[model samples]
Target: MMNIKNYKEVSSLWIEYKSGLKYYILKKIKNEDLADELSHEVLMKIYKSCCSGNEIKNIRSWMYQIAHNTVIDHLKKENKFADEVTEILGVDKNNTYEDVEEFVEPLIKLLPEKYSAPLILSDIKGINQIEVSKKMNLSLTATKSRIQRARKLLKEKIIECSNLEINAKGNPISIEIKADCEPLQKNSRKNN
Candidate 1:
């Protein structure tokens, strides 16, 4: 059982995990403002539960379970419950790589805008480099360079955040986030 007694420790955990939590919320709700609001609520709920002398066995899973329930409640309130259920049922569970991509997209959102913007436009959105260059108002060469740099930086961040082992080709061999590893920090990625 893990007990966090110090307020500072709690705040530090919040700082560390805020982005991942918000991303999880955003995945469920698909609304930025609502995700932010629900994330704050999740944080407050966790803090209160911890402070109330409850013994949390696995904090990360517990927090996510809470987040999941919160989303279900939100969906019910919005009367979108059936839609979400149908969507989930329609999804193919065998596409594990797609599952990882779903988790990874939110982590990518944590990267600094310069790196993230080009990466998102090029990789996630499937936009051509030339188009991304124009949208970013950078020369084609500079945009391509930034996109490459962003991929490198993003790969490093994913490895660091998840404590995953990478192959010679820089592909992750392990996708699980280590319990000891800190949850991903929010958009505080340094300027590169």
Candidate 2:
């Protein structure tokens, strides 16, 4: 039921898609290594789905959906990897910046699909918010709201991280201070 000609055509199409996907994903991810890694994931999923005869009638739409999900999943996996890496690096989990940035990455994965694009485009790339809105075919207000929420979330994460560090230090100080008072009480007992 399969033709060699059709397979060859699909292979060529996949190659073309890969180049575009690399640049597109790279722009959004901000890290060369990460974009390359996620692009590889997107390509693999597309190739596998197409070969499996998944009835993808709209190739563009189907490919975009797959790429989007692949990127989100990649983000989640990267966050986990970062956390593990921080631990392996002997960074203190309770008062470390390592897990803070890494943990926030996965939260971006939770943003609405509609918001993800504009936020990544405008915030990550320093593109004008209005320009990103036009590119996404979204209203300027919606684009601004997404960016605002993203900033707010990051701010909260930083504050939470600072609080964690402070709390971790607080317990140790309280214990040390209590221990210091015990020595003073022992000296008073001797004087008595």
Candidate 3:
């Protein structure tokens, strides 16, 4: 439980950081009302986490990390919610890309850090190869090779998990993660 001083500190931090955090969220989400809502959600999440009695060293880093994940989750939910609405209204019939992404993200974690980090930075996070190389402290060529190897490994895992044969166009006939796959066991974090 937070003592009076700690509670005041948390409140002061929120007051100091709320506007900048809201602006960051607004820049990504591009909706004023939604950004405001998410900003409040961020503070609420931080408050809950703080009250839970976890020892937080470096509160700024902890808050920003939560902010980052919160934004990703909000964007994902926004997209998914839109898809759901469209599906219900019969506005779209194709779900192939979404389905593959749903499986691929989880599968990406099963890979070794060398393979996974590059792939995630370049492919998933949309960071450029050069930037990823710099970030990973690797030569550009090595980063490129790791990304390629990671994709190959991911493809093999996808095949083994989904039990599907790909067609000539390099598309899976069906993308489904098998329940008993190694990635599923390795990634124990339940999907929200």
Candidate 4:
């Protein structure tokens, strides 16, 4: 636990808070160094906000709100160079060696944009649900629904991807997932 009263404790809490933030960002961003940089950006802003004499009511939530903005800011910055992100998204920019990037790229494609936004923002970026709601400009309940839908989609996609990988391996895994996703499969690949 961290308190506002103790500077060292606050700083320690800041570091811990940041690791989780970085995890979230890394999941969606799919780049460790980029995610770490974004996490640092959020924490630095929080520190500066404190130094600027803004009264934070709930330190944890307040920090997350800032994290949300940092993510939004990062997105906005990316948006300024729209062609770049679009290209980045479409490409398999897996530098060095990591299966996570290869696997996640396909999974990301399976998710709907709206559902993906909240899901990625909350689950991947480690932003709080409330902060995600705010970022998506959705009511909290709506955000919950989007997240649930995203999970459903992600589960379905992963299972599908797994089956594909297995089938490729000439393994004898049951093909039940294909039958289960029959209706979803019709439009699953279509980006809505």
Candidate 5:
């Protein structure tokens, strides 16, 4: 339970940080309404954690970390929701991308960090390649090359581990796991 002093502190902190937090989220999300909503959510999370009696050593850092994670969670959920809507509406006939993504996600983890990190930031998280290059501290050319190589490696791994049925458009229609494919089996088990 929050004591009077702690409650006052939390309220004061909210007043001090709300606008800054909202701006931080807006920069990442590019939406005013969502930034306001997520900022309020951050305040509530701070209040709850404070009420639960966790001693936060650095309140500012903790608050910003929460705000950062909230933005990331929103982005991921937004992407997934769009995909779900597309599937539900039958807007895209080539909806097998999501199905393939399920199998590919684990395979990405098996890749080397250098290769996988670039691929994940650019492709999975949907960050712009230039932004990914900046984040990864790599030249744009290097980032693009790594992404291309990662795709090739992922394609090879998929082919090695499963038999993919392709349609006339060269899209994968179905994937059948090969017998005794230990890497994928282990990855699947680990994920589960």
Candidate 6:
């Protein structure tokens, strides 16, 4: 167990994991400013828990779990649940998709703008499809079509770039990125 009673220890922990925690939150929310704020909130939660004498068996995992839960709560508040993506990918909601969620934003970024814009506006931004259509100055049908095409393209890209392990119910249990996956590599580089 780690002792976090000392302020220096907690500060060191935050300094070490701050960037990684913000990146993790950014991947889920696709917003840099919000990710930073949420990461700070996560740090406070961790400090409070540790100060309360909680025994954290694995500090890294425990910190990330708090970060993940914080991101989920933020998404819930923004009405941006991953339900649409889960439905598009045929993944069961009951099975946690935390393993796969990190790849989603990168995959979406790999799509062509014609296909990706509608998806970003509607899905990631949590705007209604009708509002997205108007914002993009496209007919509702056209916006919907683009979003659907984007989903199909994203699914195909995921399959081409990774080896997915699916459960008996056809939900992706895990994903292993292929060694030569250039799109994901480029996306990661762009972010850095």
The most accurate candidate by lDDT is 6
Per-residue CA lDDT of model 5 for 22-76, tens digit only, reads: 8777766667998889998888877777666554444555567677657657767
Clashing pairs in 6: none
TM-score computed on alpha carbons, candidate 1: 0.43
Residue 54 C-alpha lDDT in model 2? 39
Q: For candidate 2, which ten residues in a row score worst on lDDT?
A: 171-180
**lDDT per prediction?**
0.68, 0.54, 0.68, 0.60, 0.72, 0.74
Candidate 5: residue pairs that collide: none
* Stretches of candidate 1 exceeding 4 Å from the true structure: 86-192
lDDT of 1 by residue, 1-192 (tens): 567776676788788778887877776567899999999888877777656665555455556656655666777787776967556323222222333464566677767898889999999999999999999999999999988988888877676766443335543333455454344433223211
**lDDT for each residue of candidate 6 in 1-192, tens digit (9 for 90 to 100):** 556787778899999988888877776667788888999999888777666765554566557767766776776786764884333224222223654676788888888999988998888889999999999999999999999999999999888887666545564544566779987767546655
Q: What are the runs in model 4 whose C-alpha is more than 4 Å off?
A: 1-9, 80-192
- Return the TM-score for each candidate structure: 0.43, 0.36, 0.45, 0.37, 0.49, 0.48
Candidate 4: Cα lDDT at 180? 53
Q: Which is the better candidate, 1 or 6, if ranked by lDDT?
A: 6
Higher TM-score: candidate 1 or 3? 3
- Of candidates 5 and 2, the better by lDDT: 5
Q: lDDT tens digits, residues 1-192, model 4?
A: 223544564587687777766765575577888888988887777556544543443455455545545655687777647665444334222211122233444476568799888888887778999999998899999999989998888877766754432223342222222445544444344533
Model 2, position 128: C-alpha lDDT score: 98
Residue 32's lDDT within candidate 3 is: 99
Judging by lDDT, tell me the better candidate of 3 and 4. 3
The collision pairs in model 1 are: none
All candidates: CA RMSD (Å)? 13.0, 24.7, 16.3, 18.0, 17.1, 11.7
The C-alpha stretches of model 3 lying farther than 4 A from their native spots are: 1-93, 165-168, 185-192
